[model samples]
Target chain A: MMLDNTWFVEKSYFEKFAMAWKVRKKLHSEQSKFQKIEVLQTESVGKLLLLDGKTMVSEIDEFVYHEVMAHIPYMVARKCEKVLIIGGGDGGVVREFVKHKDIKQIDLVEIDERVIEVSKEFFPECTQGLDDPRVNILAEDGIAFIKSKTNEYDVIIIDSTDPEDFASGLFTSEFYKNVSNALTEEGIMMNQTENPFLDEWGVGKIYKNMRAQFPHVQSFTAPMLIYPGVFWTFGFSSKKYQGTQLNPDKIRHMQSLERSLKWYNTEWHKGAFALSNFHKKKIGL
Target chain B: MMLDNTWFVEKSYFEKFAMAWKVRKKLHSEQSKFQKIEVLQTESVGKLLLLDGKTMVSEIDEFVYHEVMAHIPYMVARKCEKVLIIGGGDGGVVREFVKHKDIKQIDLVEIDERVIEVSKEFFPECTQGLDDPRVNILAEDGIAFIKSKTNEYDVIIIDSTDPEDFASGLFTSEFYKNVSNALTEEGIMMNQTENPFLDEWGVGKIYKNMRAQFPHVQSFTAPMLIYPGVFWTFGFSSKKYQGTQLNPDKIRHMQSLERSLKWYNTEWHKGAFALSNFHKKKIGL
Candidate 1:
């Protein structure tokens, strides 16, 4: 029996006419038979979400987390048809990937089947496209799953959580090396580094480690309303493409995204890359 | 008896290997007090100290808020010596005003004696220069205080809170008329508007109200790290000064002070005015 406790918090502001939500829940109970993942929905000064205590995809006020995590690499790679997503069982990344009509396949490697199952039940909006024919859901360790592949994925997105508990090994340098081996020569990978305001050093360390294996490395900070702090930083490492320059057609395609997005627009796309001088000095950008 | 059960939350981040704190406190009992008088020290996110949760003055972060609020007006007015501060009971505004050295005198009208006394205790760094001979601390209603003065003040800074309680009248058309009456022909007035991300309409209303009274109205966004969000916006309304052109000496002064700050710098100063296109369009700038 997994502990089933999730709470939702909503914070509404009158000025901007916007509301932010955060969902929090316990992941396990000693009395449960299988590992339990509890999700809660809550709102803060700056994030929005579907408030149910089981799973969440992205905060409404700040969608850069999902947008940049999925689109940066998708737009950078020459032809990102066969992509692999590790730990994004929430289906938000897959939903973003499927936007590219060119993407023929997406291998969603999730370790715990329970998270996907819970997301499907609790967050239908976020998991709507996970069962699409093009997506291949594999219940396995992402690291081992990557090691077994050869020149398989053209783009890889790591949508894991903080480097704590089961997600600990995911942040190791070894895991990045495995990911590098699994990608094609021109493949690009973008990972949710961590909160820059809270984890600047963590971001710095990841950038240093990613640079060891990849020829090009860059990090950009995006404001996340769901997260606790100012903005979250995502690390982009690639073998060929410079993350800043995107194909004009692809940029046009991204801009033409008809989806009603609350955040992440063209100006935001350019601004995301325009890092603060302090951040630039720290990363030697 | 006052309710003492207030929740204080602090978010700290490490930058340049030093810790910076952003704090938020919720008061269950003092909601009305903030509405009536326009100052809520405990709930403010900046670095200033709150004496018994009421009075506020400049912290180290005070320079960021004061310089932009003061220097902009001074540069615009060309020879601004006489100034009036509404609700700056903590004397932070007066301290920034005195930096001009040429300024003859400043009349600070604060409504609450408690706030000044408390600020004198907790925020000694900011209030230290408050007792200067050129400054006069008048404890009275800011609106009534302004009505009594003629075209005396060259600049006026309305550093009040949201238009929820005591500060509600500060956002009215009547207040703007009185502000106009109090300023010299080329005088300028700046108000510390609310968070642009959280309270756009609140700021929009102030800009609209100020525009009704002044010939030139411009709103600029400044990054105050300690605020609820990373950025806060300030509205500058004037009869003569162009908001963009700054005195070369003041720019140099700001540049020299960049090394002493953890947040505000020259890049930030320029970026402060770079509003989102949406905001620029909304404000009709």
Candidate 2:
């Protein structure tokens, strides 16, 4: 955010587009083991987080990303109990997972512990779930953390930063194979793929890699106001269940929690799976 | 767009957020009677149009806005023959309307003549419809022009800028009554409402204004990649047609046109009308 000419801008350097907010003040700045991290207080958009100068999450619109990442797949799956979240150190996804009454365990494997410490201090709301007994935060490389698991998690979420950084290995064929091996037979996994229009990291590449390892692979989209392409997409790979099909009873049951949400709902869920022709073509669906 | 040290940015001044593009060069800049007009050659995004420093359209993603503005309403209406567009100086919406074989007379009333001239020279693809015999280009104050018509057009579209400056009158209650009188009994009018998330212009106010005049008022959303709040929303107000109901025959027919278009499809159309909980709360729906 720009205050007295002090502005924070995240440039999609190669793509030539950037998102900037007027800075009220700089909350924190430091170098993590894996990346550079900074939190700024914006004039309007609440607290903002940047890792390696890339937009990771902001307080105001973070719900859209975290809710779609955790709630959509959870509601679509037949059952979810043991869940693995890779690289969501900010605790936003962990917060959403804590809302699910059925989930008993949540393992968050983040490569950087500094991100978690900073998040707990600056964005307290997102970090509230970290205090819950269900959560287990692991400060380890996600690429290395998923190696030993076999048919373990009921749901797996990859909330990595842009693939150009340390998280590049998370969007590979071998990573998908390891994730596939780590899920139960009817498990579901979702990776935070990039925007549909200007996804420089390639949402199609994630779709292809996940499809090679999973029986049911669907790419759904949502509007993420701060992402490079506000028209953001997620790669959903499942062993069983169609992401498009919303069971009537399940939808009715989901409505009870509507009062608690800012964006996701039964209607939004249906719309999320209706892929645009642009997406269908990219995935060869 | 930044070339060397030159970067073009649009700041939502009150909102404290902005979009910037790395510039290859500034093609043209002039002050029109209405607003500051500019055509910038961006490094990545092809041609960029700016009105008073606000992004109006970009070459690469203009189709999403134009197609959604024209196609969704055309397909939803029981029948559309005569059409009217207000303030769409770029001619993108007119080009989409011209594609409908069912549409006959097309009247576009853009207040700024320079925008048309700049678009014709810099962005010809958006202005091709100006060559069609069915399309009429009328440079006038659309608010005043609509006041003279009554029950004349089958479809009316308001491709307006943000509801500030001179366009503030366009969002007033009086304009809604004038538009209601200008439409045939079953006519549909869609306006380019702001983004779903960072809707600094107030989509709910437009919904309330149109709901007072029209029987069926629906707010549908699409992702305009170049637009602020890329999760853009459109206010669809009609005397009868429900924008959400996809008539099977219309769906079958819309599928035929899918191959020719880039984004709009039967499924995407269905998804467009699903209001998010945030939108619902904002609109008091």
Candidate 3:
């Protein structure tokens, strides 16, 4: 977030694109052991959460990020009884996970504790689901947490920040292999891939690494209004379920619960997988 | 544009968002009766054009905007002999129109002559098609020009600026009626509607007005990196054909041409029309 109190600008040095929001004031600020977390109330976007000077989530448009990350993998996987979400301290991912009726358990592992406190204080719409009885919020390093488990989660959603600085290890090949080992044989895993325009090479490299470990790997995009380019991508890797194949029965059920979603739908789910020629060549689809 | 020499920031005061680019240097600046025009050579975006302090286009991601705006209507419309483009002074619309072998004539009506000159100097990639023998460049008000014509063109694309200030009249019900009359019985029209997040009521009003004039109306979205929100929408109004149908044979032929289009394809063409529930409800789709 920008240091200035009235305005918050998230400038991407490498990408050379900046996004700024008009803020009312800083609501909270705390420097945790892992990262610095701050919440700002904005004029239009509502409360904004910043980690290490990077805008993580806002009360407005958080649904785009949370819905895309959680719904894509959760909807595709057949048996989504057990789910693991890593690095979603704001609880937006958990908010989406609770929408699924069949999901019996959810574990959210966030390294930074301050983000949770900020979310609870500011972004209640996103953090409200953390109070669900089925959810288990664990404050731990996701890499180490995933490494200890095998055949555990039916679906894993990494709602982490960009793969740089404190979160660089999450995109490494070793972490992907560990994630693969932790998931059930038919489990699906999705990581929040960076913008293709800004980090084409990085996304390609991460997709390559995930492909090396998983049988089926693909990338999908969603509108992230606050991100550098506004369009953010996600990498999907599955051991059994192909991301493109959608079950009609599951879609019918999801259609009945359409009120829970804002951005994603069954048609959009199929359309999101349809990458452009440029993106298709980049990820070698 | 931001006054800073090394960086140019496009901030939308109404939307409460800003996009900044690191620039090498300023190339040119001119003030016309319509608006202020400036050209800047950027580090990554190549040549950037700003009209009235609003980003018009950049060399790097112009394809995403131009391709989606031009190809969506061009590919869907069966006959493409004659076309009318209103207010695309940069020539990006004409550039994409000439790609079709069937398109014999294109009439480009741009109010500001300075924008055309700037495009010729800095954005030749978008202006090369302006010199085609079949293309006619008219320096006049698009509203008055369209008002005089009837059953004139197979496709009419409104590539104007946002519906504000001088261009506000273009989004009215009477203007849409004029556009409907200017088109052939089976003609199609596509307007560069603004981002929904920024102009939800404006887009909804335009969509409602267009629906009253045309039999079939639809809205599609595309990522415009420099816009207020990354997701920009386009309004499609056709007299005959449904917007969702795609011709497989034409797609095959277009693919055989092998042009290096950065951000459009047959699959994406279809995918672009798949609206999210939020947008669908907003536009009354």
Candidate 4:
């Protein structure tokens, strides 16, 4: 038999045996907020959130979730000077948003103070720009915060978790209406919807509701390794801006920001909007 | 704190929790060839094989590896009649190859009788045509079997595992030389090289070596969920065919094969070749 003591095959078997040792251990913790959150070794791809145990951004290769959530609105809004971020306690979103030097003020509404504290401690690299004077961190409910606000912000990003307990309101039609009310006439809103691979129906529902409130609704997908599914889909809605009218110049400007990015690049910005034929057919894009 | 007990968030949380269960327990399996291969569930997403076992087709999403390994050869050789698939015991590649009615015969050389045995037992839908008269199954080492063959095969697919143990010989330039010698003058060869996300260096090295022997050498990437890294890449080399010269009629004919595929649609066929500008520059596409 060809399988007789082949050195290469045997070495592979040995390597597989050794990998069992390298697999990281996972730890689960229940917060004072009664949230059951689990933390694990960042592993080969995910990064350890140095500041907080409650939240961690997977490594740069998995930054599609953050990049799309931030860039889409920044690209759509013609003049996004004042922005509001809801529940992005990790500060990665703020870091991407501040890239637009024109962003004079940023209001980050995070309900859990612990997520910010944990992120500040564990994910220093991702949260480095949190101290920027333009950012005002508000530990409050995002829905309530948006409801009280007038048409003051140029862009609003709902960077909340999956539509679970505390995050459920973020997915509601009422929340979307409130978001529409909170944005200026030309404002654009983007939300971290969920894993389309598993929750296509849920994502479709969100897209439909957002369409009802906003004149233009678009959904885009990106790969996220840390998420339950391989791909995470996000939805964007605007009264004035259309997704197809993506300003190439603004995207090029964003691409020139760091000169070095492992994941998001110019081609990706355009390609990310190019959905699978199935999705395109479904969304009528 | 807006996170107060909300039913919508609760429902979303349960849905996400249930998806986690499905991924950990039902969708993905931890069993290996040395251990035990189990089918936690069975579902079809076109002509693709969704094996839950770690070894059968180590990756659940085999489109990336299978598509490049299958399409490149068919694209290169304008007219391919006799095709040989070695070690794709799961029948995914065979399903792709059978798309062209012009393929007169497909000889599947697989050593681990257990692979085909298990595939037949669990992946009945994908393996539906294994018993077709045009297919010849050789329960033997692919290397030995290929060395004994003459210039009869028009396309040879080495659908083996990683270049670690049993699959080590398959990766050697020597095995490729054998493949080159076994093919007809106009024949082509394709193989699942490695995970580009984890082994770009290794893939680059293999691509370099393949370029030495074949007049044409190219590599393409596709997304596969079950691989060590989420994305997988495959290398294609041939003495006579170019991937860009895909005959429109031939592709249309291939699509006519009633094997419904979730990922490999005509648009995907076009998009698969649409490399990222960065990758295109790297590969000199």
Clashing pairs in 3: A1-A53
**Where in model 1 is the C-alpha error above 4 Å?**
A1-35, A40-64, A72-83, A102-104, A147-155, A177-188, A196-220, A236-247, A274-285, B1-85, B88-109, B113-117, B125-141, B144-157, B173-256, B269-285
Where does the lowest 10-residue lDDT sum fall in candidate 4 chain A? A5-14
* Fraction of native Cα contacts reproduced by each candidate: 0.02, 0.66, 0.64, 0.04
Instruction: Output the better candidate (2/3) by DockQ.
Output: 2
How do the residues A99-119 of candidate 1 rate in per-residue lDDT, one tens digit apiece?
A: 778899999998877777767
Once model 2 is optimally superposed onto the true structure by TM-score, how far is the C-alpha of residue A45 displaced, in angstroms? 1.1
lDDT of 2 at B114: 93
Candidate 1's docking class is: incorrect
Q: Under CAPRI classification, how is model 4 graded?
A: incorrect
Give the per-residue lDDT of model 2 (tens digit) for A1-285: 122356777677375878777788888899877778999898767888988877777887998888888888888777788999999999999998898787899999988999999999999999999999989989898899899999999899999877776778998999999999999998889988787566577667778888899999988777777777677778888888887665454666577876788888877787878877788877667
What is the TM-score of each predicted model, taking all chains together?
0.68, 0.96, 0.96, 0.74
Residue B112, candidate 2: alpha-carbon lDDT:
89
The sequence of per-residue lDDT tens digits that candidate 3 reaches over residues B75-188 is 788777899999999999898888888889999999998899989999998999999998999999999999889998899999988878878888888999999999999899
Candidate 3 regions exceeding 4 Å error are: A1-5, B1-5, B13-15
lDDT (C-alpha, whole model) for all candidates: 0.63, 0.83, 0.83, 0.62
Better of 1 and 3 by TM-score: 3
How far in Å is the alpha carbon of B45 misplaced in model 1? 9.6
Query: Tens digits of per-residue lDDT for model 1 on B123-151?
Result: 67667778889988888889888887678
**Candidate 4 chain B: worst-modelled 10 consecutive residues by lDDT:** B5-14
lDDT of 2 at B263: 82
The C-alpha RMSD of each candidate to the native structure, in angstroms, is 8.2, 2.1, 2.3, 9.1
DockQ of 3: 0.55
